[model samples]
Target: MNALFFISQIIGTVSISAILILALAKLFSRRWRGQAEPARSRGYAVLVTGCDSGFGHHLARSLDLRGFVVFAGCLCPDGDGARSLTLQSSSNLKILKLDVTSDEDVQQAKKTVQENLPEKGLWAVVNNAGISHWAEIEWSTIEDFRSTVDVNLFGCIRTSIAFLPLVRASKGRMVYVSSVFAFFNCLNLGAYSVSKRGLEAFADCLRVEMASFGVKVSIIQPGNFCQATNILKLKTGSDIWEKLDSERRQIFSRQYIELATEYFLSTCRAGCEDAGPVVDAMLHAVTSARPKRRYLLVSAVDRVFFQLFPFLPTVLTDAVFSLSSMYATRTQMLHAK
Candidate 1:
């Protein structure tokens, strides 16, 4: 009994020592959470790309209201997305043009960083600029593949490398706006899925690589159908649309578009308000003493189901995809007609 008691005491001492060492380490480095940032600085200092539409613009505005100095960047400031953001005045908000695919734009952003934050590193850089091509592998051209990579993958690389030092210096965070499609597959979402999967890998690698440098990486996987501007204007009259004949278009209008549109619009409406959750997640990455490595919005239904579908028998998965394709095929026919 005495021996057992001694062993228990030793274990208790060891555990307590380990915890104290951690506390001391945190204190000595002065690297843990700094005091909450002042109202002027906002709660965080964030630079977000692709703010011309969708998540980026909404996120920027959302952060602004919460007292984060937001640098909203995009390719064009003329569109409705840009104009709406541009009209807003937040001394905390600064709108800039950043074409993620262009080296020149990337460099200019780098210079702007030195100019604005010569003394302090940015708290976060949100890489949100990306595009999608919803088509099967057979329909995807080499150029299509290259374009997708250029914008989604290569653009992330540029922004990360350019802004990595700031993240390291602030011991801040990098939020990669990945998609549920990264893990979930869709038949016609080939090019988009491929690129997003690469992004998921990138985030994983980045998190590990930057851990020691006082940097962390996080991913945001938002679910199905947030309404972004100009979706209705997608080149529906292009050659791609022509492939869907009149009979197929008629079939889709009767069968799927209504339900699909309703799903999309409803999700987006909820998502607009739910923006707070993701913004809260980003804030944790930016200011928390300990940050999470991954976050999923749990709203991406098709992609979520796709992730699980692979675990099912191949035949079952194939059957599910086949049914989903029928709607798209009919829509294609309508578009063509």
Candidate 2:
């Protein structure tokens, strides 16, 4: 008993030390590594996708103000987001109607960008267009998974491939705006997580391949900013649940769906509202002479749960998720009663 007690005490001490080390690292980590020569924004062009809203829209305006000739790709060119961006910036900022999922639209966008590029060529391409859908793996259909991947994963790939020549011509950078979901998973986000995870892998390979070409590739992992992006507003758990078949609907009863939707909205409401930090990360990635390979802009909650939790044992992680699921289920049951 004494020996077992001593071993347990040693384990506790080691665990506590590890936690402290991680906390310190996170707290002290610099946003950008090394002092890079300042980037000349004039005459340099950057193409940013998904300017219709969210991170992309904010980033387009930010870069334009910083003197970059900005090509803002809006899925809805005449929409409020695109119009607002155009109204807010000078002629240096041009809005391009780009539907990343459509090949014809991507080609047209490429042509438009080429027509406007200075002799120095395009400086950077920020692949920020993506979509998210919320539904448990068991509840979601293959179509749901495909649609999510189409926008979140394939869209980045499409934009990057089309813009590579421009980026290479200027020896510029490619920045992919991924999510914290790329590194971690959560309930009702299976499709979204899978898509971002694939994007992370794609960025890894592209970074290695582009290294020899004097072009840099960076991935930005932003925390939950659903409010800022309007992602939760675009699609909710209830929206997905309503489309389910009667049999599936019975499995996740109406009461459960309502609770889940409420939970989803609450989480979104709690997410980061300001997109400034994330946009800053993107700017650094684009303009820095020596940008880091990856930037993580997650919140404290994300750091603790997704970042640190992964270092814990699998059983511990499972237990944490399982307990949360149990609580949610119990709450639903009570509500049903």
The global C-alpha lDDT for each of the candidates, from Candidate 1 onward, is 0.70, 0.85
True-structure lDDT of candidate 1 = 0.70
TM-score of each: 0.69, 0.83
Per-residue accuracy of model 1 over 154-231 as CA lDDT, tens digit each: 899889999898777777779898777786675456787888889889889998899788677888775553443322
Residue 141 displacement in candidate 1 (angstroms): 1.6
Worst 10 residues of 2 by lDDT: 30-39
lDDT of 2 by residue, 1-337 (tens): 9999999999999999999999788646633343456459988899999999999999999998989899999999999999999899999999999999999999999999899986567999999998888877877889989999998999989988888988887789999988888866777799999999999999999998997798889999888788788665355556777788888776777677677777777887888899998999999999887787888888665665666765888778667766786466845675663
In candidate 1, how many Å is residue 41 off? Answer: 5.1
TM-score of 2: 0.83
Best-fitting candidate, measured by TM-score? 2
